[model samples]
Target chain A: MSTTNNHEPILSFKDVTFAYEPHVPATLKDVSFELPKDSFTVIVGPSGSGKSTILRLVTGLDKAQKGSVQNTARTRMIFQGGALLPWETTLNNVKVGFTGRKMSEAQKTHDAMAALTELGIDTLGDSYPRHLSGGQRQRVGIARALVSSPELLLLDEPFSALDIETSKRLSDEVLRIHSEQHITMLMVSHSVEDAVMLADRILVFKDGHIAEEIPVSLPRPRTITDPEVQAIIKHVQGTIPSSG
Target chain B: MKVTHTELQAKPRMTTHYWSHRGRRAHRTNLLHRIGSGLVLPIALVLVTGFLATGVALVPSRISAEAGTLLAALGASFLRLFIAYVFSLVIGVALGLLAERGRRLESALLPIFDVLESMPVLAFFPVVIILFLKANLLEGAAVFIIFFSMVWNIAFSVVGGVRQTPEDVKAVGVVFGMTWKERLFKILLPSVFPAILTGSILAVADGWNIVIVAEALRAYAPQSDKAHDLFGIGSILVHASSTGDSTTLLAAMGILVVAIALVNIALWQPLLAYAERFKFE
Candidate 1:
């Protein structure tokens, strides 16, 4: 595991509130949290608990109705279902991240290829999203996010569509990337196990509020069967209200 | 496992192999074969038209003269249809973009368009003729009628395309920091290209269906005569049929059929194939 200094906050939500419809109650009400730089933080909660909304807020894809979202990092979002452009090849999809940048076409291609190669998908650069497996597509999505070298990477249920083994493999790959790059990583997931296994810090959300913030100080390469990891997972799961 | 240079080299060769196999299969039904097969019917129709025009095989001299006149009329009709179709395409796509921009615009415009589209185009002919005649644009009146007949299908198709745009794709654009203009041109337009192509095909067919009626309106116009009337296949066919000139009528119909067939073969087929690249699936 790579060491990270938690002295600096890369992003923070200060009493943020938002609503999709004027007649409805706010989806996120007085949500406040700080994400430390170079930390892997996961926001876990039940469905419609506004964990995903927080990710969108951090990425600036949604605006807060009240209060403020403060961030000091260049950010990119990894959406659910990969969200790779179907018409673009893997390389081209990643290359899109370089849009508006001052780079030559060849330099953009080279950087895109490098990003894909890092994700173990360099050979699939020419393959369209429709032609790739779900896992492969997600890797391309990661490459697209990573090619820009964002200081903050936000992922919203990115591995929920994959099987357990594939999800574990990708989770491990994400850990490796996070440790190697020391980027601030914020992920939102409904899976307690994923939060326990992958996150350095877990923020539990309930009813649009941060119910608890749990820090996993365990050693690297923690397994699901580990007592401490399982204990944290069980605790997080118990905190979330069961659906009737 | 770490990837090596050798593995990278080998991967592209595999891609090449896969594509080469696809290319070989495509080579069997290459461009030459496609063009040759497409031309067969049009070529046969041309030969028959030529035979009739030359008064060969018992065709009367008067019938031959009518056929020559009908061919010129067909050319005139096609020119008008082409102009009308181009104008409709631009207006339809522009209106579609406007309608797609927001719910308020769509609600305000789509119902009006729906009503206009369903009304009999001939009902608007008098209005069109008067408007254009006052402007001294007789050809413009005919073109406008055909344009009205064709524009609605394309506009509706564009609306459908915009509505069906994938949510994920839009999110991708947003996350990537693409400007509104870039998103419109690079993503939105390409995503709707297949829809546009489908709409254009329907519009062209609609144009063909109405072009005859639009041109035939010339027969009812004041001071209309063979020498001064609108010169078009529809006008010629109407005149020949009314005068009991069966040979001229047959030739006019034959020429129109051949022209439509040739356009479908030479233009629409290739365009449809190209547009398949833009389809999401």
Candidate 2:
């Protein structure tokens, strides 16, 4: 047991190992990482590389069979396909994130609207998730997560369903929001390019272990065309073995 | 693709002008046409009901009073049906929830419910009558018969609905930190609403089907008399049919049909439409 201190990482996984079934091979084996306060990190790997398992562990959705997961920050997750309540309008969906809070209905509504406003989708508050386009749905997802004012935002391939153009635009919007809010963000993506563009630090997973950890010290608003960014992307891509 | 600057510029203005002018007029016409179309069903229902009422009124003098008597009987039957339906719904949902609480419970109880559901309610009427007679609860006995006929469908439907609740929806409840009570009312209940409604429709139909048998059981009453007999549409229909009074029987049957149609239109249809909003994509 360690004492709480300013120097401690906001989230830490110490030799964590997990499996869906006891007899099967572990999905995450002896996985360890630390996310410092207010850092933007991306976990990148190929499909079935256990990137999402790591996320599940961090969000406390799943438990590690061995070792320990220490998370101090209050966390909110944006699931793939947005996972917005189909029965609720965007405002109501966002308001649902504040369900356990001791707040008035008016306060919840105002906070939800404010979160949507921050994402520039306040006008869509009355629209249901089915009525919104993919990008719009993800924006509502972000607003839902942000309304809770969590210290850490976990994104599980939030933009995987969008077109490339929409994905890039949303990536920029997420980056801007990250900068403005100064909230710690940990995103799981299969796209190395997305990792290079958005993350301050990238953890590449392979065969249930961290293959490499790359630091992106490049200036803001990075592009794939940049030589340094391309080099890092290439390096990260090279770390994952091809299935064939 | 290539487009001339003039063509591109002119296309937008022409399209907007043409659409805006035609849109408002078309929208108004569509609205009025929709309203007219919507009124057709209700108008036809009213006309049919009126025709039936007139036919019943013009029946022979021997059964001239039968129409009014049948209507009163229908009202009485409806009251019993309502009570039985409400009782069944509460018990069914509670049992369904208990069954869904765990695999062992579901396995143990679901088969019993299935067997009880398959057995005809009439088979148990003798037992019900004897029990209620001993307790001096004849009305309770009749309602219990109807409740038995209707409850199984609702309970099974609820079990299916609970099982079919999507994994992601349940995950959302957990992630959002909803208490068990909140999860039950807010998530589980709303998620299963369509199933409950579907079951209710079937249960109501079953209730109507069994009401005649249930109310006409006065023939088996211990001290058979008008006082012992339940006065409802079922009892009147049975009496009319037994006496070979075709006019009274026909009028009573017509009244029952009209009553069912009215309840379907006024109650079930609107409820079904309202429940549609709770269904997940």
Candidate 3:
């Protein structure tokens, strides 16, 4: 969430293209972008516009078949689904995201707890993800991504499954965490309002290309109703099709 | 007025009664309930057929008491088998992980495991007897038989489990910078719990049958003894058949059947349930 000019770019995708099958066209077509270090960038697009694919590429889930993707910072991805190991508790799910770190068990648990605490669901640590509400599950996903102290966090529609009220609350919580942790975040979202509210720069992906990059330049502690956010929302709405 | 109040109470009570009866109907019609109920007819038929063919009336004497004894025997064997099973699991899972993680190594080694699995373990009797004789190792034959029954399943299951791990989950592990050891214990093992348990249970069941051959035949038993010295259920059945002691034969067979059934019910089912609980949708 740091939008200041002093930091370097933490990640870059230069003309990267990828496809599941060689015969099919690339899902992402020569897409390029830079994530300014410690800043929040949201990639908004119609469904199947390759926003999720970009996040996947950055996180190394799918390798870029063409062009290059360079990540200067250590990257961890929060899948759109919580992806909690079915057998583990919420705390353990968060802990899974930090496996093999040289930190002591105590430190790992402590860090996981702190992340959960930041999201205001510390008491639910012992509860399994199966028992949690959708919003709570997403919180576990976020805690998991952050617990690793990742330098770059990729969120693939992490809040899309929740109710609007819960999504807004979680968004605010995520923004607070971003400000506190100073982690660079690249989130894939469908909501223009979400992109405008949370991003330092909103990159609209269309037909696998970044059709627009609308810099919010809005003040910190902004809301959906902010004039600058509404203007960016309008601009993104204009550039991208209403239906995917 | 008092009578009217009593009638009102009785009306509510009758409605409660009606709902309770309706609840039973609902439960009985449920899919799980139907499956549970359907199990009764087939099992009863099998039991009746098996019992009638044995020609031994279900007597309250030793015949009934032997069921308890058979249960105890099964319990003891289960403990021993469990120990072997655990050892097999560790070794199998380790090798499985190796095979999965190292494709080239797996290709080189897998054919051997395949050969081992396909080779009828019964064929190894003479070789085991000869080896035990040469090595002056008592019980070596039994150990060989048990090991033969166990190793392949463990290895196969472990490999399957490791191979079946979802790509997304593995990617998560890599992103977290998990060491090889961490990946094996934390990610691979839990992910393959169902497969491992399934394989191990099958191996254990297979071991029971093989143990009968190893114990009853006693390839090196004295020629004059006529196999009567053997203490296993198979030996008992063999003796009973030759002597026309049909009741004893059926009793022994009953014990074996019961042992196998108890294992499937008490042990394998629970293991399967536990493993399944870990399985991701």
Docking level for model 3: acceptable
Worst lDDT 10-window in candidate 1 chain B: B15-24
On the 0 to 100 scale, the lDDT of residue B87 in model 3 is 69
What's the best-to-worst order under TM-score? 1, 2, 3
RMSD of each: 5.9, 8.1, 9.3
How many clashing residue pairs, candidate 2?
Answer: 0
Q: Residue by residue across A159-193, what tens digits does model 1's lDDT show?
A: 99998878988999989989999889999997899
lDDT of 2 at A54: 82
Per-residue CA lDDT of candidate 1, range B1-281, in tens? 33222332332222111111111111234555555655666656655765665444434567566667767887898898889888888888888889988768888999999888899988778777778878888888889988998899888888888887776777677777889888888788888877787788888888878777677765545555565356688877777778876667666766787777677656766566555456564
What's the CA RMSD of model 1 in angstroms? 5.9
- The TM-score of candidate 3's chain A against the true chain A comes to 0.93
For model 2, the docking class works out as: acceptable
Compared to the true structure, candidate 2 yields what TM-score?
Answer: 0.79
- Model 2 Cα shift for residue A126 (angstroms): 2.4
